[model samples]
Target: MYDVSNPHYMGDHTGTRKFRRVLLKLSGEALREPGSTDNISPPIVEDIAAQIKAAHQTGLEIAVVVGGGNFWRGVSASNKGMERATADYMGMLATVMNSLALQSMLEAMDVPTRVQSAIEMKNVAEPFIRRVATRHLELGRVVIFAAGTGNPFFSTDTTAALRASEVGADCVFKATKVDGIYCSDPNKNPDAVRFDTISFHDCLTKQLKVMDATAFSLCMENNMPIIVFSMNEPDNIRRALVGESMGTLVNASGKDA
Candidate 1:
């Protein structure tokens, strides 16, 4: 068993070889086509799966944590009068749906896949077990972590960091709408500067919102690196897997290699 808690466990972060294992964090919006009423788009999922398939072909162990913002946002629903816990639970169900869709597409592409849900639904997905998930990855099976840590008030971003730390992943790859982290919201600030690399301490001190506070804290505490990059870029997933340096990397040191 890979002991992530061991003090001397220096993950495969040498950048001397291809990443041994990584956790990809994808938002639910990635599955929905913009300007379309549909909540889930097959073509978008297929595109994402194709890139992942190409990367998996390289023998890199891949695990994914998918968010549920497309179908539901717990905080948004709660603010509209629904109970917070109930709204969060509904959000968890949404992630399960997205996970199943991605799994179907990856399997259709002949890539072995598994969906592990934190909130178990026996007929559809296996209950999340750390050892089992690690074993699946070791066997070269792609594992999609769904249901957001089986608890309310925890964002999927936090789940990504937590899972990466638990599984001894080399880094957390955040597939987002933006190309990388910027000094400000690039859309709003035309002059916002993008950093090739930034330190976790700087990210906090500067209030760069690469992720939620809890997620950032978790990654920092675990010394897990995060790569923030755009999912819309063609073959970006594969590029990231092979360490082609396309996005902003957040780590202990603020320097890019």
Candidate 2:
């Protein structure tokens, strides 16, 4: 009954993906429309949940780290003269809300989901415990990590890097507005080049922005791979999980550099 059609269901009967374990990083802005007033669109997230359900049925262990930009941006607020820590904590709370919303949507779709809060909001979600989260994955549960590293001055991008490592995920899939890594701002620079793959060393040395420096550094240091792809096109998430290669793959070896 979805207004938008779901991807062809892979179900429990499908072939294995190249990556058996993955961490998906979704931005808060992804849940909202570009010019609309709604902070979180029901149909959009429903479709996303449907995609995740299909992907999970493919037998991959999935973890999600969602940002709070749709609700609040701490750094942007801090630049406007508010106290930095207070602003960041507010941003964390916003992520909790987004996580609860996502958990509700996924569970509504009959996909077993858990919301693990880094801030310990026991009433709403389980506390973030690495072992417990890993066990949840082993049990075929979709784990949503919220509250961003349980500290101030950190970002959800950093949270994804840390959790992906802790959960022993094979890779991190960053679903965003842009389709892949570009040599320059695709919007501002019409002649910018899109890279199918890039090495972490080049991403750093050339100052290309796959993610925040801290997050990127962590992934590089740990030899973790990241796939950056667009979420605007339907089924991109499923394609990514299926390893169809629609995005830029950032790797540890500077082979592609």
Candidate 3:
């Protein structure tokens, strides 16, 4: 149940609004420029920070879960003969780097932010504490969750789901290259159909790759809504925060396929 009296409450329980607080899931590749040698492009991160700043100005509580694919991919490394646990730990550290980069840019714009790493790194960030993270959101500080559950086999997607549920966020906004969920991969299938809204059960039954199985399962179990949209479009993050419908909605109330 949502408490209307909570200072962090941005919407009412009567369905007049949605998404008071949300978790944003971003891929490390989002910060990288295509065909560039650099792992992270400053210009791209700046753009993303600017968008986030714009949204934060609207008084939305934002938490971010970013992946570490740009610097390292544990699964890929493990596939290439590295130990899975070691590679994943390194991958977690890579997320911290991205988190710090985003935090620096946001602070430069005067947006209060905090990075909480699942893996304790006292020199750089606060350890992941659910209450502290939620308090940061209530205080209008953007919280960036790094380190992917601090585990070897989990993903940042699962982190988003877990943190969103733990913090009682309204939804999880998944930023991706595609506009929304489709019947098939739009890149490979020209005849793919996009759904404006789809039920969690439908996504599962159809085997749509909205997120990793663990992440999707977590959301489904928690009744957490997810919005999947393209982050490539300018001001899309701001638009999404302000409740402009531009992506597919995956939730319990969605129509069954």
Candidate 4:
């Protein structure tokens, strides 16, 4: 349905985006390089920004919810030797840093971007205001949401689902290290089976870890569809926005399955 070769192409054969509005879930760990401890890899982040710019140029309203695992994984920190709440707050700050980095790169690509934090850092980003964020999206500006629901225990996956519902997004695109949800860890099991599509009930029955339980439940309750795809492929973000079948789709109805 999409012209995969042209970055500026917005619509499909039907002359319109299959999904005009989508929420992109980005993990901070995805920004780091192999064997590198850097919180934000310049080349990686810039490439992601370029992809986002390409999709943005097509008139799609894009919103990103970034995680903080590259800087600090809250759960890991708590396991190592820190208090749970304190570690999670630190992780929230890490997300802020990643958001700023992404904003800078996106702006350099001439894509107007805004970083909104739930924790309300007036200096670095605007406070998370639902109306203002939606307006930014309506104006074709990329909005980066950070701080993971402004709470300690929640995750960025929940943020993506929450923001997608809040902004009336058609679907949530989960940019992941793997190509799609599998019966088992693809990295570990060579025989793992990848799912092109799966119902929410099936996902829960299998206990697939595409998203945390809370996040998945929220999307299921709201009847939101989620596409989990690999970010390793260049321009995959733009491709997904244009409705290419590049990942496994999760929904309440298993029609796509």
Candidate 5:
């Protein structure tokens, strides 16, 4: 069990409590360190599990959407002449693998978890059912959604947005390598400006690449807010959940007419 004595307990009022329930979106690359092959590193998985456990202990309902970029990317495979649909299906399977690995880590920490796939894989996980997922959340099970909307050409970002809306999540936390959204690629341009808050419309007009067009459109249409933050920082996940002002907040409130 994690030492609750640490100051990072989830519900602490020192941090803002922006939302009641949240959907966390993680990329497949997050499972492994950069330049490593596709697979979940034990340390990384455990670290993420610990963070989720902390948030779970705070009595917040959490759900996750994981991507499959490490194992497969339909766009890249299609470039190699593989059929788009076939490549996408392969990507979906990769996400299932990631989901199972995450589930194992979360369960090891004694956090109850359920894996729900957009495509049916009864032997491995439950099919994507909105009510079932909601019930799982109500029961305090951390639900991990996999398979990227069960369709071709749609990115996992879209899946996260859709799942967040369906589960009635107050916001979607997009865990990324960077601390927040910037005016330019932070790595490429050291002087790039980071936005504490940005409107979805401005992000779209600026082509900020916070998320793909489809996902951004879905969130904008639904008025769902998304918080982009760094996953590398140990307590960042808990911080974001508790509404600490740590990353970029993108929503309708920040949107410009």
Candidate 6:
């Protein structure tokens, strides 16, 4: 169990009210280091669990949605003649694997975690239920949503947005390798400028690739702010939760004002 009595609580002084609840979206690749064949690296899992534990200790309710790209991508495979439904099912299974690994890591750190899947896999996780998930959060257990909405065509990003809306999360945090949204591909364009904040309309107009069109639209329509930031940096997850102003904040308004 995470010791809630620890004195290392980092405070946020940005005057922005802290989010009461948040949805964190993790990509499958984040469970491993770059260019590695391993599906679940022990160090990466430990690091993530530690960050999540810290944030949870601060009294913010959290829910997670993980992608299955590290093991497979149903849509990508379907383009090569694989049956779309079958490929999607495989992708859902992959997400379950990632969710289990994450749950184990968080539990090892005493963070109290639960895994819920869209498709019923009674042997592994509970079938996703909105009320049950809300109860878990209220009771201080981290809820990890898996299986991608139990649908074939939708991506996990869409699932994250949908779940955030369903659970009334105040914001969605997208953990990426990059620190923030840039004007262009930061890797190729060294001079790409990073935005401290951005509007949903501007992101769509500029064709920003922070998230898919479907996910972005859902969040926009519902007035949910999404933050994109680097998970590779130590303590970034906790910092973001505390309103550190380290990521690109996407909201409905044209500006933060």
Top candidate by TM-score: 1
lDDT of prediction 3: 0.86
Count the clashes in each prediction. Answer: 0, 0, 0, 0, 0, 0
RMSD in angstroms between candidate 4 and the native structure over all alpha carbons: 4.4
**What is the overall TM-score of model 2 with all chains considered together?**
0.92
- As a TM-score, model 3 comes out at 0.92
Structural similarity to truth (TM-score) of each candidate: 0.93, 0.92, 0.92, 0.92, 0.91, 0.92
Steric clash pairs (candidate 4) = none
lDDT per residue as tens, model 4, 64-97: 9999988888899999999999999999999999
- Per-residue CA lDDT of model 1 for 34-82, tens digit only, reads 9999999999999999999999998889999999999999999999999
Please give, for residues 57-86, the per-residue lDDT of candidate 5 as tens digits. Answer: 888899999999878899999999999999
Local accuracy by lDDT, each model: 0.88, 0.85, 0.86, 0.86, 0.85, 0.86
Candidate 5 local lDDT, residue 22 = 85
Q: Candidate 2, residues 83-164: lDDT per residue as tens digits?
A: 9999999999999988888899999989999999999877999999999999999999999999999899999999999999
List model 3 lDDT by residue over 106-181, tens digit each: 9999999999999998999999999999899999999999998999999889999999999999888899999999
User: Candidate 4: lDDT of 56?
Assistant: 87
Q: Model 3: clashing residue pairs?
A: none
Q: Which ten residues in a row have the lowest lDDT in candidate 2?
A: 1-10
What lDDT, from 0 to 1, does candidate 4 have?
0.86
**Model 2 stretches astray by more than 4 angstroms:** 1-17
